[model samples]
Target chain A: MRSFLSSRWGKLAIGVVLVGFAAMLPLLNIHIPGVLPGPTYTPGALSVLAYAMLIAALALSYHLIFGVAGMLSFGHAMFFAAGAYGLGILLNLLAPSGMPPEAVFLVAIVLTLVVALVLGNLVGALALRVTGISFAMVTLAFAQAANVMIRRNTGDLTGGEEGVRLEASLVPEALVGVVNTRNLYWLALGILVLVYLACVWIERSRLGHVVAAARENELRVTVLGLRPYTVRLFVFGAAAVLAAVAGIGFMLLQSSATPRISTADFTLTLLVIVVLGGVGYRWGAIVGGIVYTILDQRLAELASSSWIAELPPVLHIPLSEPLFILGMLFVLVVMFAPGGIVGISHRLTKGRGGKKDAAEPAVLQDLEA
Target chain B: MSTVLLLLITGVGLGALYFLVASGLSLIYGLMGVLNFAHGSFLTLSGFLGWEVGRRVGDGTWLGLVVGMLVGLVAGALVAAITELVFIRRLYNRHIEQVLVTVGLGLASVALFEGIWGSDPIQISVPGWLRETTEILGSHIPNDRWLLIGAAVVVLALIVLFLQRTSYGLVIRAGVENRTMVTALGIDVRRAFTIVFAIGGAAAGLGGVLASVYFGTVSAHQGTSLLIYAFIVTVIGGLGSLSGAAIASVLVAVIQQFANYYWGIGDLAIVLALAVVVLVRPTGLMGKVKH
Candidate 1:
């Protein structure tokens, strides 16, 4: 048992079990139906699932910078928004008629990747010079600049204050065949799983170790002859690509993109999700994503009910009440559950083995100390 | 040329309002390192209070302003107390937690405000004496705009006196510079924080009244939107520097007005200008660089 627990294959097996359970979640929902009966099987449910998946991807990408890389980026939404708009513009130009829509989608994804890389490089180069809060503010400046540029040049392509819409050319044929909503959901879920696995793989690799080490102590990493800036730039670019991919996925789900999508609200939402899920934990992102999605959807549903509608106009709040609730959740999490769901889970599990390891020195003691 | 003059005057007037809002934010941050994201919402709340008072007692603009300021004082103290007891007290040295908690508070305040007031913008007309436009450099500028500028100057003088001329203000400044030393000297740091917060709140309330009169309307969501501009001013002026905030507010107002005239893009141009300033000067116009 001890040997199995220590082995990498054992960990891989556990991961496989987790993924298998996730894959069968829809089946499980069917078995226990009508518990929360608002379109769990329909195309609408699939669309919501797709959105949740996209949020998961975005949250995971945020974790890469904030969790693994130890850089708090207050403006990562800019890159995501930029990628979506880039794709929107590309699909508009291509206008795939009778040709496979996947081809156009792929083209858009590639374009978004390129854009993300360039943005990541430029911003990383400038921001890496400073650390901590300044880094966050610099990134915010970039995002604000992107938002302004898009809003100002509205006549050219952004659809101005009205926002840009997705033409029919971007929707794939495969998506059309199996309920476009289902296909989108599956696509987003598949991408999310793939990205999560990629992140886990990276976390176990030599590059991940270097990055983790750099985050722990940049000066120490520098003394060890590692170029912290190069490592940061690469990780930043990779994370940007993940965020961009999520953006494309969001476009697929929403069928449109607006400058408002990159606003402070979205940024804060992502931050809350990350923090609520436990900042640096891997599985925490997925857990956080699911919780946030459920909470958001439920609150939105409640806010739009007939009873709410019947209330006097003075007392009735708008769709943003969900955001308010989410914000409150964030504050509570920061105050009481700093470790987040995953962190709390770890603590609980670790408690079981406490007596056995009580006498032993802590792992990562040098770093923690 | 007349258009330019109009834009400039309007910009200056708007800048005066920005100064009022940003000064409160600056003082709060300066004293306690608490980046009160809810500052703008406090302004909105004060406006609501003023509007309610104006509606109740007709032709009482000055009275409304006074009521707003008093309400602001109470609101600020209450919020600061709650936050200190509930959140800020725990995260005294933790900057990230401080930011997150304040942001959450800001969001909750918006929700509460919206729940009470709904989404529609509320119009608040100034009294007759303040409504008429006076000729200024061949242009008809509203007396309300002049009043805003004058009020900002007066507030600035009062704040300066309070901070520089009074013992309590000296203690507050000393706390900002060295909290540990002040605590060591047997001063109640928490009490000092409460006073600073109340003062900041009052300033925001005053700004909110000006905003209601100038815009001729108030909305529950105004705080969130206006927050972006105030944040820009705070950043460009240098975080935690009142003088820097004052200067940055004027700069932002003038630039924003010019952008509105030339660029014709409502909020985008000003946002871009602010971004440019941050890029050029990360520490702000007068912010001390941390080495």
Candidate 2:
């Protein structure tokens, strides 16, 4: 069974089953008391799931840069924001241009993609010049600059502190109102699948091999006459574009693009998601994103619950802050479970006499190197 | 001309604050290779606690302010040292994990602070004289600017002295140059790591109180906002270089002031300057370390 599961057809069969199950989730009447706010068929549950899928998509993109390519970036949120705010502002701008709604929507998305592509290339080109912590700092500085611009509402385009809302008139009927939430959920699911497949393709491609090898030993890659810089830049750009795609989904689902999306904190959250899912595993990003979103939402509810408020101040204060809990969880994961959820699961399987894979925790390997 | 003077002095004053935070960050990164994300949390916590103590002692008085500054300094050092000992020590030799730990601490601590202090910026009373402006060469410079500048200069001098004159400083210098060589010399370098964290925390703590004076209030987020600029300064000055941090702090702050006044693009200008410096000379202006 294990050998068959490791085979290509078995993996494909599992993938089909999982995707089909996820697609049928909204039609199911399942109710998870602590996890989902309502039954799966309800708009609330669907919206929450949609948001999770969108975040999962974003995390997958981040996984490409940090997990796959071993580039730790603190500015990834800027690309996501570009896609969200870009599509938002463009829709608002082009709404009154006398074009059909479909044409306007298509043009806005294309423009957003172009903007994200340009931004990705520009930032990647400049930031890739340096390596390690300096690279992280450079990305951070640029992101901060972008955040400042978004907050300052340069040219009054970003709507500043209030953020930009999607022009309902410009959006297609299938993705606009609360009644169309299931459609949006389907859209989000589609995006997650698309992003996941893209990540898989990228990871399988020759470029992915070169990038991974460079992460392990840049000197060795250099010796082989490969410029690690160009390949790294390419992966970075690809990740940025993918992040933008997730951002577009986010804007559509939420119907608004806020300055909050552009923050360094948001990028940090993505980093946490990537690490939590198990840094080097693509599936880890997806799992981490889903788990984090649900936990974040549930924790907020738990914080405001009557039982929590009745507790002592010490317990009350810590529990009331979801981020605080998540942050501590992230720290614990880094310290105790370096491979994150995937690592722990792998260990459990190995202990159960499952097929032993030779892969160690990538983060641990990074440390040993 | 008077305006230029005001901007220059004020810019220098702000730079002094950056140096306070960046100095510790530079040393810690230089010697330990940890970026110390929690450095800002140290500042924030110290600022809150120092303000808490100072108000109980006496608010709106010079003595109160002085006492607060000292409290902030001690608080910063204590928390930083504890962080290095407890969280950082366990992750020893694992640079990425150490950074992740700090990042987690930074996020968690900020949230906890918001819970305890409330998210709003709390106004703190300063001495009456500190609220007044002093005339300097026909320009009315805020008196607090002088205090900030004075405190930062003393900090820079003291740190320089410590690094050059102390045995621990010698170990740190050697460690920054090459940790393996330092370890090979049979020196217990872990103690030096704790010392660097402590020193960095102290400066950030002092900067915290002064930052309150500069901004007229302390918010849960003040440290984080300031830390970003400090990071830019640390990078432009070249990480691990005290002198580099000092020079870059002033240069970045002055440019920020000038750009903000002239074109309302202070933050963008600083980022641009950082980019130019990084691209042109990745080692930074005064960076001697290869990293």
Candidate 3:
């Protein structure tokens, strides 16, 4: 624990205070004084915050594998879906309604973790066998096939194209009760904070350094007389479990898990979040998640109904198709801001270029087009 | 005996579609050295355009079929050029970015396809003569299936011939082996790469049109699905190896048919086979050992 908070004590302290504020957000308000009538702390905002926090937590777990371990996986949705459906099935089949919600959640989480262990180890073992582009493509095939399998034939187990509704008894009442909004917010924010700190510790640990080195050059690690695969596989398995836990938070917040859970688009969403913030950086995932969710949600509203919809075609660019805008954003970020928002700021803080950051792969400048 | 013959034809016919799509994918990967995640987008888009042209001229006419296919081929080639010039050409070595940008392009294109065509799978028809069935052994088989088989054989041969006989083909083969050496030789390797990409697009367009007619409908999501099969074939065949892709596609198709016939597993068998292949041969079944 001391080592976990060893050097980042001040930052950790501030983060805890901020979480406290978030937990008490319903009682707090932000006033613009002249134009605004009240604090924007509405019930809707709580749900959005909870959702964003869960997503950000999930994104952080992805950062552990992709950013830290340099393993690009397209099958993360598999883990997410498994965690969600695992909980739903446990509640529906094994647990009685008379069981305590807390006990049910604990059992469900344990079950989900077991599933994650088996899956994470299996996938890590398989995925670690390939490197670079083939790695991404192979994982993609696995996930896509899984998506097809679960959606059409396994309706009895998965609810098929229509997802199974999570039982009310599965989630702790404090997390889902009508009047327990504050408690839900506290739990979500708390989990987000814990997951964030845990990821930060992972990044700072010796294993984290080893994973980073392996990510940069597996051959180098081999030359150094260390096995890169074993180190990366360990990270992969742990990160998969964390991601599964985040999925449980997502299910608890939404009160249901749909077949949409397994879609590649969801994994893409996580990818966009990680890239939008910055890969490998500690805090980028959370920032990226909040920014992405708000942008996605608001852009849709502005395009369809808000006064922003009445704007000229020029301004309505992203607001038009929205997905076109998101796609374009991804391209532009990758092209110009390869380090994303965090890396850009980090670079600006230093001198120009700053030795190109070892974590960054071959730059787009090689294109020379 | 008839059942066996039917399965064989079925497997071969399926393999031909996989060949048409995967061959282009292999060529693109071979010559360009970039994974075109949007290859299926071209397939889907071209198939839809072809179907539209065919529908206007009435079903199953030679003129309509030719016009439709031509439309698909031209559009596919154009898209490939634009895709290369606008995006891919600029991001050569940064593969993760390549995956993201191409995936984004593919997704946005799928949305555009859905917007234009709606979610409905558009019905397409083959020419009357092509639709007729002939008895082979004891089972009746569609004449178009034979046409598909013949087309596959011809395409494969033409590809080999072009590579072996044409100066452009030699340049491509050399470029695949060593891009730098080929460029140093004053071959304008990038231009060669562009042509190869356009050819890939054209081939995928051909596959798209054939798939539309063969499957009798074209859906927006088929691009991603077909792309997966193409990826599977290309990967298993050894990326950029024409012969490898050809052999692997047929093997995968036979496996798919067997699994579906016996266990009703359909595509799952392909995924499982791929998993097994990756475990045993990480580079793929026919993939050249990389240094």
- Model 3 Cα lDDT, one tens digit per residue, A1-369: 434533468567767787777777778786443222235366566676777788888889888888777777888888877777777777786566566777777877898889987888888788778876677667777787778777864647777777767788556556666466556666778778878878878878888888888776667789999898888888888887888888877777777788787887788778888887887776778888877876776666656766766788556544456666776787788777877778777777456433345344332222211
Better of 2 and 3 by TM-score: 2
Q: Which residue runs does candidate 2 get wrong by more than 4 Å?
A: A363-369
Off by over 4 Å in 1: A1-7, A24-40, A96-103, A149-153, A205-215, A218-230, A304-320, A354-369, B59-62, B180-188, B265-280, B289-291
Q: After superposition, how far is residue A324 of candidate 3 from its true place, in Å?
A: 1.8
Cα lDDT tens digits for candidate 1, A129-213: 6566546656776677677767765548876556667775466666543365666777788879877977887778888888888
lDDT of predicted model 1: 0.73
Provide the global lDDT of candidate 2 against the true structure: 0.92
DockQ, candidate no. 2:
0.68
How far residue B104's Cα lies from its native spot in candidate 2, in Å, is 0.4
* Interface RMSD per candidate: 5.8, 2.2, 4.7
Instruction: List, residue by residue over B1-291, the lDDT tens digit for candidate 3.
Output: 887777778788889989988888888777665778788888998999888887797667888887888888888888887887788777865556776778778866776676567778876677887777788898877777776677789889988999899999999988877777888878788777778878788878878888887888899877777788878887788887888889998889888888889888878889888888888887776676242
In the predicted model 2, the residue pairs found to clash are none
Error of 2 at A189 (Å): 0.5
Using alpha carbons, what is the TM-score of model 3? 0.90
Computed on C-alphas against the true complex, the DockQ of each candidate is 0.34, 0.68, 0.40
